[model samples]
Every structure is written in C-alpha cells, then in structure tokens.
Target: MTKKVAILGAGSWGTALAMVLEENGHDVRIWSHKAKQADEINFKHTNKFYLPAVVLADSIKATHHIEEAIKDVDVIVFVVPTKAIREVAKKVVPFLTKPMVIVHASKGLEQESHKRISEILEEEIPESKRQAVVALSGPSHAEEVALKDLTTITAASTNEDASKVVQELFMNDYFRIYTNDDIIGVELGAALKNIIAVGAGALQGLGYGDNAKAALMTRGLAEISRLGVAFGADSITFLGLSGVGDLIVTCTSTHSRNWRAGHMLGKGNSLKEVLESMGMVVEGIATTKAAYELAQEKGIEMPITAAIYEVLYNGAKVEDIIVSLMQREGKSEA
Candidate 1:
C-alpha cells in the first residue's frame, strides 16, 4: 500500500531516504529549511550541495513550508540533526493534525538530556499528534544508499506494528529492512558509535596501523556495550546491525562525518577549524560530550570515550590522551 510521506530534512541522508521511498512508489515530500535548497530539489531535480552526483526523482517534491510538507501525510520522518531535532519537532507539532507514524532517521542523543531522538519526538509531539515513534538506523551511509548499493537497516520501536509499517515502507530489492523491538539498544548503538568512529579517524590521522585501529574498534564496542546495558538496553543488541555493524562502518569509512572531523582534529586542526571545514553537523563532537558526562554520572568506565572527550573538549593533546589510556591499570578483559 502506498502512503504519503513527509521527510523534514533535505540533507544528503534525508534526500537519499526520499529516493528509497520514491522507488517503493510512495508519494514523498522533502522539507528543507533553506528556500534555495528546496528550489534546487524541486525545480532542478537535484540537491547539489548534499547529493552532488545523484539526480533526485522528479516525482519527489520539495518544500520549505513545514505545514505544506506534513499536510495529510501518513508518515513523518525527522531527518534533521540531533541538535535540531527538538526545534524541528516543535515546528511540526502545530501541523500534525492527524495520527501519523513518527519515524526519525537522525542519530545521536540530546546533549542536555542525553535522550534518544524518539524520546525527544515523544516529548515534543504529544500522543494525540502521532500513533507511535520509530527509529530507523544502522550502518547504511547516505552516499552509498543513493547509489542503490545493497544496504540493510533496522526499524526499531516499542510498537511492533509501527516498526513493521516502516519496514514495509522502505524495503526494496537493493534496500532491506529488519524489525527490532530493542529500541533502546538500536538508538544507543546508532548514537554512541559515532564517538568511537571519531577515535578511529584520529588513529588514522595519527599514523596508526591496522592493529591499532582493530584494537580501538574492539575495545570501543566493549565500552559502548557496557554503557548500553547500564541504560536498560539488551546486551545482545550490541551484536546486531545497529551495534557492531554501525561501529564498523562509521569508524572505518570516510563517509562518516564524525570520522572525518576526528581525522582533521588528529591532523592538528582545532575543533573550530574542523567544524568550519566540514560544512556538516559532525554529530560525534557533541555526542562525545554527552556520552562522557553520562558515563561519569552512571559510573560506567568508558576509557575510549573519555580520551576523545578530553581531546575535543579539554584541550588535551591526542598523543598524551592515548598514552594515558594505554598506561591505565591493567584488568582482566571480561
């Protein structure tokens, strides 16, 4: 069954998802905050700034108006940055006149509350304005997804029906969807992996070999799983697509904004300079702060996260942080 979908972001990830829904024969409308980007997507059938090489389907409509985008839509996908999730959700609330499945594709927690994207949506969009909240995430990269690469992701929700609805909405020959009930694990894995990805990039920038990268990734998963289990997520969920899968891709690939930002930082650029050069949100920068504080608050030992946090926030040299991490008191690997 075809549905009207409103995606409230026009960046590369949002536009790439629009392509997936369009191919599935759904009526897709993308909302962009910038009028010029909206015009580019609509009139030119391309979003040069985000997806430079991919030509968006002419059937996919683009608009700068929020109300027009969500008007009578069956599904509302929030594809904005984590920092912008609350603001955008507030903007859409006044227009959510009917029950629609709320799905968010953005990854990362709210810096202040450390709440997942679905939590922010649930708080901002009242139960009357939506049916259920779902998080769609995994190792899939926007650039590769736009190229029609074989990709698989998870649609996680406390509501099984809503997850299945999203699963059916986006699944295609090249793009596959799996339903998971572990919303907490799925969301946390999706968000926390960015922190490790930054570390992986820093390793690359600092001239570290594959052995170092491998150790970082393995130990990083241990930290993520420890913190995740403490926060009520299923420990086994860390083994799934949203966990190990996401960590591998985001940490190893240049496609990750967090990894790219970390690379620049490891290469001796200031955080300010890295952010200015990326022209993108680079979620791990903010996520590192939130995760570090959360770990400390909960008494979870996340050495990798602490190292990256110190490098990004406290002006600690990466080399010194690495040495400090390596020289920590030895303990048995669980």
Candidate 2:
C-alpha cells in the first residue's frame, strides 16, 4: 500500500531515502531547513551539494515548512543530525494531529545527553502524537544506495509490527531490510562504529596497510560490543549487520565523511579544517565524545574510543595514539 511519507532533513541520506520511497511508489515529501534548498529540490529535482549529479524523482517534493511537510503524512522519517533532533521534534509535534509511525536514520548518540537517536525522539516527541519509533541502520552508504546498489539494512524496534512496516516500506529489488528487536544494540552499533571508522581512516592516512587497519577494526568491534553489552544490548547484535558491517564500510569507503575527516586529522589537518572542508556532519566525531563519556561512566576499558576522544577533543597527536595502542600491556587476545 502506498503511504504518505515525510522525510525530515534533506541531506544526502535524507534525499537518498526519499528516492527509495519514491521508487516504492509512496507520496514522499522532504523537509529542508533552508528554503533555498527546498526550492531547488522542488524546482530542479536535484540536491547538488548533497547528492551531486543525481536527478531526484519528480514525485519527491521538498518543503521548507516542517508543519506543511508533515501535516498529513502517515509515516515520518528523521534523517537529520543527532544535534538537530530536539529542535526538529519541537517543530514536528505541533503539526502531528494523528499518531504517525516514526523512523530514524540518524546514527549517533547525542553528545550532550549521550542518548541514542530513538531515545531522543521519544523524549522530544509526545507519545500521544507519535506511534512506534523504528531504528533504520546498517552499512549502506547514501551514494551507493542512491545509485540503486544492492544494499541491506535493518529496521529494529521493540514493536515487531512497526519494524515490519518500515521493512516493507523500504525493501525493493536493490534495497533489502531485516527486522530485529535489538534496538539498543542496533543503534549503538551504528553510532559507535563511526569512531572506529575514523581510527581506520587515520591508519590509512598514516600509510598503514590492511594488517594494521584490520587490527584496529577487530579491536574496535570488541570495544563497541563491550559498550553495547554494558548498555543492556544483545551481545550477538555486534556481529550482525549494524555492528561489524557498518564498521567495515564506514572505515574503508571514500563515501564516508567520518573516515575522510579522520584521514584529514591523521594527515595533520585541524579538526576545524576537516569539518569545514567537508561541509557535512561527521557523526563519528560527536559519537566519540559521547561514547568516551559513556565508557568513563560505566568504567569500561575502551582504549580505542578514549584515544580517538583525546585526538578529537584534547588535540592529542595521531602518532602518539598509534604508538600507545601498540604499546598497551600484553593481555589475552579475546
């Protein structure tokens, strides 16, 4: 059945998902904060800055007014950054007269509260107006997905029917969806893996080969699973698509802004420079702060996360971090 869907945020990922929804034959409206961007998307059917050289479907419209975009939609997809969720939700609530199923593609913990994206949505959006919230995440990249690349992702929720709803909405010939009840594990896996991706980019920037990156990625998964398990997530979720799968793609792919930012950092560029150069939100940078703080609060030993935190926040040198990681006291490989 075709449903009216509102995708909040017109970034690359948002636009890409809009394409998927349009291809699936839904009435899709995308909300952009910038009126100019919305006008461009509607008039030209292209979001050049975000998704260059790709023509958007005419069925997918863009709106500057959040209330207008969401007023009559049956489903709402939040694709904005973690930091913008609260602000966007405030505007969204007033326009929601009926209960709407909520789906989030943002993969990051809130830097200030360390809350997952789903938690932030539930906190900001009133239960009376919102239906079930599903976490849609995995290793798929916006660029690849926009190209109709064969990609698989998961929609996780405590509510089985809700997740299945999302799965059906997004699944197609090129895109596949899986369902899981491990929302905590899925969200954490998606968020925390970015930190490791940055570390992987750093390895590449330093001219380290696959062996070193493989070691970082392997141990990085261990660190992510440790934190996820501490937060009451299923341990096995880490080995699945959202966990290890996301880590590998983000770490190695040129399409990952987090990896590119980390590469710049490893090559001695300032964080400010890297961020400004990319002009996109690098979710891993903020996630590193949140995960680092969470590890400290939980008394978990996450050496890799800590090292990335130091480099990002304390201006710690990349070379020193690499040396320190290599020189850690010998311990069991498990």
Candidate 3:
C-alpha cells in the first residue's frame, strides 16, 4: 500500500526516514526549511547538508512549502530539531485535517516549557484535526540508517493500531520496528540518552579507556531511569530499545553528534567554538537544560545530567567536573 507521507525537515534523520518510507513503497514528500536544500532533494536527489553520499529514492519529493508537503498526506513525520519543532508545527497546523497520524522523530524536550515533542504537537495542532500521535526512537544513527544498514527502532503510541501501522510503514529487511504503548518512557529514553552519550564522548576525549566509558554508560542509565520514573514512565521501559539500547549505541558510537560535541568540549574547546564547528544541531546540549530543569522541578536526582549542565553552562572545567562526580557519595545500585 502506497501511503502519502510528509516529512518535516530534510536533515539526515528526516532524509533517512523519507528514504525508508520510499523503499517501503510509499510516496514521500519532505519539507526543508531552506529552499536550496529542498531543491537538492527534489531535483538533484541529493541532500548535501546531511546525507552527502547517499542518493535519495525517486519516490521521495521535496519542497520548501509546508502546505505543499502536507496536503493530502496520510502521515506527517516531524523530524525538525527540538528547538525548531514548535515553529514548524504552528506553520503546519492550519493545513492539517482529521485522521492524520503524526509521528515525531525528533528527540529532546522543550527547554523552558519542559514539554515533550508530542506534547508540543498536541498543543499546536487542534484536537479535532489530529489522529494518533506516535514517536519512533532507538539507537539507530541517521548516518548509518541513510546507508541502508541494519537498524532497529521502536514505534510508540497510545493507540496500538497506529503504532502497528507505523511499524509496518518503515520496517524493512535492514530496518526492524517494534511497537510500544509507553509513549512517555519512549520519549524520555530517546531524549535522556543523548545527555549520557555526551558524557561518554567526553570520557573518550579525555583519553579515558573503555572502562571509563562503560562506567559512564552504566551510571548514566541509572540517572536516566530516575528521571524517567519521576516523569511517570515505566522503569522497565528504560531497559528497552528506546532506553538502554539507544544509550549504549550513542555513548559508544563515534557517529553520535552529541558525543562528538562533548569530545570537543572535553578537549578544552569553547561551547560556541564546538557548536560552530559542528554545524549540525547536537540535541544533547539543549536537552541537558530541559532535563536538568525537569529533574529540579520533580525533585529527581540526576547527577550525570547535573554535571553535564555545569560543564556546558557554568564553564566548569572537565577535570573538575569529573572530580566532583567521583567524589559524590556512592550508593548501592537497586
């Protein structure tokens, strides 16, 4: 069945998803914020900004106009960066109709509002015009996904049918999709793991070995689970694909943008310098603020997140941050 799929954002993840949908025998329309990017995908079949080497599928089309992309589309996949999601949602809201399943692929909560991507979507889009809201997340990296490598991810929604539909839409020989009902846990796992991946990258940059990375990842999962539990997510969900699975991959993989950014920061580069050099959005930076704020508001203990926040925002030296984390009183793992 060829369904019309509209993807908002033509970044690496967005483009990779569009390719997946196209390969799944669906017609995909992608909207890029930049006209040149849209033209590159639509005409040249190449998105130089994100997936430089991979050629996009012919079934995928691109446009700068939101309405053009969403009009008559069966499913709308929101793939814009977290900071830009609200603005894009507002732009698309006026054109939306009923029975449109919204699947958000972006990770990270809103900084000040502390809203998840689905929450923002609910607020921006009218209830009468919305259908099922779904989130797809896992350890899958956009770069590898674009190359058609094997990747596994979970599609979560309150609506079981919608989750299955999404799973069918994107699942392929190289891509495996699982379904989950715990939307909160899925989103939290996706967002929180990036923070830990940054910490893992910092360890690597500081010339630390696998022992340090493993310790960071393990303790990082604990902090993530604590925050998720505080937010009403199931504790077991943290052990699933969206949780520990994503964390392990992002923390250990060199392809993670958040990890790479942290590596530069650990090498004594300024935040501004690192971000400017990276060019792409490293979601963990903004997510760290949002996660930290949520932890404080909910009275949850997230020492790893707190340390990253201090290092990124308070100009704390990497070595000092490490010392502070190490000196914290240790407790038995429950």
lDDT of 3 by residue, 20-121 (tens): 888889989999889988888778889887877898776688999998999999999999999998999899988886568899999999989989999999
Q: Which residue pairs collide, candidate 1?
A: none
lDDT scores in order: 0.94, 0.93, 0.91
- The order of the candidates by lDDT, greatest first, is 1, 2, 3
Task: Residues 87-202, candidate 2: write the lDDT tens digits.
Answer: 89888988889987899999999977899999988988989987799999999999999999999999999989999999999999999999999999999999999999999888
After TM-score superposition, what is the CA distance of residue 230 in candidate 1 from its true location, in Å? 0.9
Pitting candidate 2 against candidate 3, the one with the higher lDDT is 2
Q: Which 10 consecutive positions of candidate 1 have the poorest summed lDDT?
A: 91-100
> Which portions of model 3 miss their true places by more than 4 Å?
none
Residue 98, candidate 1: Cα error in Å is: 1.5
**Alpha-carbon shift of residue 193 in model 1 (angstroms):** 0.4
- Give per-residue lDDT, candidate 2, residue 127: 90
TM per candidate: 0.99, 0.99, 0.98
What is the TM-score (0 to 1) of candidate 1? 0.99
